[model samples]
Target: MRKRAKKHNYTVIIERIREMVRENGLQPGDRLPPERVLAAAFHVSRGSLRQALQALAERHIVESRQGQGTYLLADFDSVLPGDAILEKVSEHDNVLHDIFEFRRIIEPEIAALAAQRANVATLNQLKVLVYDQQRALFNNNEVDQFDTQFHQLLVAMTGNSVIAQVMQAIQAIVDTSRAPWLQSRKRRQMSIEGHLRIIDALEKKESDGARRAMQQHLAAVEQFIFDNQ
Candidate 1:
């Protein structure tokens, strides 16, 4: 029974370990002490301690290299925020702004391309995302993932895999920005409306209209970010 509860204790152990790492400015490739030593430090059994290490390993925070030992895999900034709490990547805030500018550059054109090239099937996929987003909002649930789905689908509609790949990379950067822009009901409503307008423009195959709608939507997003800040 004692052993059984230790499985659940990994989260706590990992939590403390992450806090220490942040305090010490631990870097990538840094090796933690062996499991037994960690167990002794934390006053937890070796079995429980190994479980904590394994959990971090799964998150790309730590890596095991067979003979050498476990190594820290996450960058210093990346590891600061553990799984339970998200933090702003303060070091890359300017990069994030640049990323949004990149969005401004790439997104409007993708929307125009979508208007021209999106097949009925691709449009239906966008519709599905909108529907899921609406359902989440109605249920008072978070719409972040669903919201991202709409943009991701729009990028795909460009019929250019390269655009999709670049958009995906941008999405990853956006995800790391810490303060979620979609946690509020008001934001979700605005996003849904924006999506609807974009979809309407795409459905009509009006390139200019689609481009305008996409640019308007992104402008609104930037305003919302500023308003919230």
Candidate 2:
């Protein structure tokens, strides 16, 4: 009975922490209050609070970086078990087809919205990403990080938190599935060209053009994956 009561208290504390996060409007990359502060605020023992935090961490609700404190992840789905989409793709043997189908349904619209809403700061940030991608290519380095950031930034520029969260989740799945295909230089160069077109449309604030560019880009990526496979 005592163990049951303790478990119940722990669950309650976890929910309360979630409520605190929402009430605080804490976005991704935001740091939580110090351990002592959070424990005191929740009126829970430090041990109890630590247990709750560990649960959240396991679920990717929060991440603790050594010497940097706990920070919320941009994608809450990051901690989803292997049985999620990643496993589905692996078991089905049509990973690229599945991922590109999802991108076709979602990313073009994301690009259109980003073109409509992106500010100068966002545009500049995207330009920097493009430059970084090009630099990586020239240096014969991997382009996966910049490519992922480029897409994520587009989703975020849409100014819709719900869409941003959904895309973040989808992207986590895409990242795991694209690992093998991203190793090809031909594919990497083609991706760089596609990114340039998308950036050009966004810079001009042409929503339709941005949408078309993204569609064409994804089509090319789909073809590359199909041919290589």
The TM-scores, one per candidate, come to 0.58, 0.59
Clashes of 2: 0
Most TM-score-accurate candidate: 2
Per-structure clash totals for the candidates = 0, 0
What is candidate 1's lDDT per residue for 67-169, written digit by digit as tens?
Answer: 7777888863454444542222222334546656767787889899999997889888998999998998899777778887788788778889887777676
Per-residue lDDT of model 2, residues 1-229, tens digit only: 1111112344566667766777898888899888889889999877557656665665667888888888887443444432342233233335445677778888999999999998999999998998998899889886778888999899889999999878776766878545642346777788889989998999899999999999999999867654443
C-alpha local distance difference test of each model: 0.71, 0.74
Model 1 spans with C-alpha error above 4 angstroms: 1-93, 177-182
TM-score of 1: 0.58
User: Scored by Cα lDDT, where does model 1 land?
Assistant: 0.71
| Model 1: colliding residue pairs | none
> What's the lDDT of the predicted structure labeled candidate 2?
0.74
